[model samples]
Target chain A: MNTTGSTGLRPILERHESTLLANWITAQKAAPTYRPDLIKENELRDQCRDFLRALMQAVQSGSQNVDGSEWQPVRDLLASISRSRGKQGFSTTATATFIFSLKEPLFQLLQQEYANDPKVLAEQTWATSVLLDRLGLYVTEVYQQTRDSLIQRQQEEMLELSTPVVKLWEGVLALPLIGTLDSARSQTIMENLLQKIVESGSETAIIDITGVPTMDTLTAQHLLKTVAAARLMGADCIISGIRPQIAQTIVHLGVDLSGVTTKASMADAFILALKRTGFAITRPTAGR
Target chain B: MERIPIIRMSKFLLVSIQVDMHDRLALALQEDLTAKINETNARGVLIDISSLELVDSFIGRIIGTIASMARVLDAETVVVGMQPAVAITLVELGMSLPGVRTALTVERGMQILERAIGPTVTEGTDAGPEE
Candidate 1:
């Protein structure tokens, strides 16, 4: 009932809570970013209702500062919503629109409350805009954090997935490398290859690079470094799977791969490895 | 300075570095190994460094120096049992220890030595029939 402009938004929100909720839902439903496919209408309605209730409770403490402790529940609600939306594959615009869309219905309420006083209406509208903007930005921050963690987890998984050292025969180990070899990934590959070599006490290691798409000088250098490390560990390393283009690139770049024995395919490398390890495989006779 | 013992095996000299070597000790070992190789007329020298976890550029260079010195003395040197970390560190340090042979274990080192210089010669008293 106190319609004075000196009072903050709490009174206005309290007097027209239902009307504001209804109008806010209408505004959100009509928002361009609203995703009916991603979120059910009932679920969105529940989220809006809960957010409005938390906002009302927090504003009752007379603190317009969003960072104040009274706004803890509001922050928690927004963060949860943001994180959930992020996991649900909502775009940044769509997630941000959840908070920003409330501005339309809110400005209408402010206008009606200060119908005779344009100055008060303008002031309240600006304050509401700032408040909602801060909330929207907070939601984006949480959503970005979720996305970053998701990316970090995927990178770790990819690193684990890419490098696999297999023991093809006794005294022979095979390391099949896939994907682009960056410094970090090459470090991992070297460490993994060396560890397996030590564990198996293998005499020969075949490094198959068939899955590797391109062979730049850097990749070749990393390959040479790994071979050198393995050799220092008393394991002779052989590089295999030199596609014609990669071979031409190495020759064009004037990289010295003479020290490393290479084969055109992994099968040839495996046969040579078996020979070095003094193993012979003979095919079975036609019938047992 | 405590001298690293150079044990004379059949046709090879074996040096196992058990403790961390100081600069003086490494120098002493280097002199002792070369002298021992000369005195024994050994065909090969096997240095076991499995227990050595940490190696700096100095030790790496010393090993390289020993291998080169042995090669000059008409003897093959096989550095054996180098750990993976030591190998990576050596590679990173750009010391590949070229011209020196390497093996996974002392057994393999002996095999390499045997393959390079033939098997140990038997004394006249215990000569056995050839297979």
Candidate 2:
């Protein structure tokens, strides 16, 4: 609104100002029961827009005479805006605008004063790296927490899901898996299988996945890697219970599993493995 | 539980075959070739079946797939170092790798790949017969 001697770059500032007003109007219209008395949201759109315009003018002209102290007012305005909007409204668009508006001025100041200083450059780089690292850690922690909550809810829904391991002859373990084999579950399966193999001194592991819906290149590669890792520890991995659909998917995806021993079912895999180790299933037939 | 080794060279993808692959090697070959074609612009692929004792229809299908994929990607694909027993078994099963290049050794396969990539030096350029 202070239009004295603000000539060049006025159009760009006017555009941004209009956009902010439009966005604020839309936000207010969308609210179920808008409160007029909320001082935080009442003047935020105009205040922030004005502050940004002033900051841009100061940066463009390289005028240090124009008070840089106006930045605190802008920062305070953003803090209040963030508090009023809450986390859900903190979109990338808003963050990007704020960062871009500040970055130009910051870069200009640094270039003017510390351009020749290697120590200052190093310090700035180190500080930026630390900030980025902390941001990454925060994002990862948030994702893990959300995933854990979701998994807990799912577990509660599927109360009868069994985690049982069927023990075969001579320390061999047979795991019958059903449903989809995602990367996370595959990792868990590998960890559990390795631990069981070591603890039971089992030389062979039969993984029955007859109930698996389909297969892709990634899943096939994961299975191959698991088998290879098992061989490294002197144990052989047998994949069994492959459904017809999974076989078709493997062919479709063009993944090669030529070196893996596969069987029709857990029983077949178990018998074959046992026979190789000189053992037989001596139990009598029930219906005969 | 047989172990399969996957080794990658400059322009070749090598997969080592084992005993259990006897039943599915054909299909595996076809699939692997198809993937290689789709994933890379490499000139060739070599399947080393020296350790394999037998070959079957499944393996034959895989090899065919690889060849088909290679053709699509505008690259040449080859199967090399097939053991005598495995070759005989494949012949007995009435299976053949259609449109696929076959080589007797890994060295021969590399040569094929190099040739497919075109002459490394200019056709007319020479070192003047070692002076």
Q: Which candidate should be chosen as best, given DockQ against the real structure?
A: 1
User: What are the per-residue Cα lDDT tens digits for candidate 2 across B65-106?
Assistant: 766777677677666665444443454455544356665455
After superposition, the stretches of candidate 2 with alpha carbons farther than 4 Å from their true spots are A1-165, A283-288, B1-131
Candidate 1 stretches with Cα past 4 Å from truth are A1-7, A117-123, A286-288, B119-131
List model 2 lDDT by residue over A174-275, tens digit each: 877766777667656666665566566666789887766777787787677666545433456799988788787887888777767988788889888898
Give the distance in Å from residue A183's predicted Cα in candidate 2 to where it truly belongs: 1.9
lDDT of each: 0.88, 0.56
Best by TM-score: 1
State interface RMSD in Å for all models.
Answer: 0.8, 15.7
CAPRI band for model 1: medium
